[model samples]
Target: MTRFSANLGFLWTDRPLPDAIRAAKAAGFDAVECHWPYDTPASEVKRALVETGLPMLGLNTVRGDVGAGQMGLSALPGRRDDAVSAIEQAVSYADETGTKAVHVMAGISEGAEAEAIFIENLSVACDLAMRRRLTILIEPLNAFDAPGYFLRCTQQAKSLIEHVNAPNLKLMFDCYHVGRTEVDVPTTLNKMMPVIGHVQFAAVPDRGPPDHGDVDYRPIFSQIAGLGWDQPLGAEYKPGGDTDASLGWMVKFR
Candidate 1:
């Protein structure tokens, strides 16, 4: 069977962290992931895992000045130290919590200089992540969501990974974004899976569960199982109603 990993950050926004874990357990999730354990500190993160017995599959690293247009200055020529420091913090946090992967937020300004900067910073992050045994993943946001932001597709992400040539550096293949931008899902998935370290999904336009929107998760998940992807498929979508109410559909399939 294809296993499912619930994203606690989206699933239980209205509830407490402990309650979210219990809900996932009752909903029949095998594992879970989160965006970042911001409100829930490291000790609380550990406690939630212990109390719910839910293994954390993955989480994200912090992006410096995300709101201040300074997202991902790591690759820029002069800001390598800042990037390295950011990566170290995320790595240490991952180590303490038993998570395997972290999202390298590729936030950047719009211009000719952005690409060069991203490449430089990502290369350094990869080197550091390799030492930490961490699979540092880069996610491509759809242009609609991030107009000036760099990295808007799987092919672009794959190129960066190949150029970096580090096994620890990989792509975060988010389906919801892909669904709107790409013509075919499975075909694109097959082409990109080689460098893909993580995946995220929401219904195409609405960012809801599979059934609520046009994307049929059953078929996609079936293909995922056929592909032998044993890693967790992150359900990082907003709920149409109360978070738990929208998840009954997920419980049936998971």
Candidate 2:
């Protein structure tokens, strides 16, 4: 069976975090993921998870100072302390909520110095995550959607993971961003399977539900399954309308 994870960060925007978790459970998600749940108490999130009997596949570290235009903290130069603090916070929440992984966001930064900071931060994150037996994921966002984002391609993510050389370090492969940044999704997926820790998807160009997009997810999903990827495929997309009403595309997978 192809398991799916509802991404609360995009879906069910109208509801509270706990309610969204319940909605995702009702909508047939095998698990759930979120952008940032720090605003909501971990106990509340954990209560929802326990009530629904659903596992949180992953969650993101806080996007440092969104008002100040910080996409992430990990890659920013001279922000190692901030980056580590974010990781520590994420791990604490994940540990409390039974989440399996945390995606350490690479804030908008460029050059070798930025990359070095990211590696150092990730190394620290991996050490911290290991205590909880949790994985650390780094994703490559498309420039169009997140201009100046440090990580921009599968190769870059892979290289960083290799450089970090942490057992817990891995990649969060978002198909929407991948489609926006690279051609031939299947080829890229195949190339990236080894390092991929989590996989997310949305319609290309519009970032909507996965049913109607330039990228065909049926074959892509098949390719993922063929590659022995058993983790839940994250449904991280903008619901064009009611979150529950926009779930028609999930039937085929269920």
lDDT of 2: 0.92
Clashing pairs in 1: 74-121, 75-121
Worst 10 residues of 2 by lDDT: 245-254
lDDT of model 2 at residue 200?
95
Q: Which runs of model 1 end up more than 4 angstroms from their true locations?
A: 16-18, 66-79, 110-112
lDDT of 1 by residue, 1-254 (tens): 65677887788867776678778888777788887676666777777777778888777766677677654545445666776677777777777777778777766554557677777777777776677788888887776776655777889888889988888888888888888777477898889988888777888788888776667777888787787788778888888678767876665556
The TM-score, computed over Cα atoms with residue i paired to residue i, of candidate 1 is: 0.89
TM-score (C-alpha, index-matched) for candidate 2: 0.98
Model 2, 70-157: lDDT tens per residue?
A: 9999999888888888999999999999999999999999999998888888988999999899999999999999999999999999
> How accurate locally is residue 9 in candidate 2, as Cα lDDT from 0 to 100?
92
Q: What is the TM-score of each candidate against the true structure?
A: 0.89, 0.98
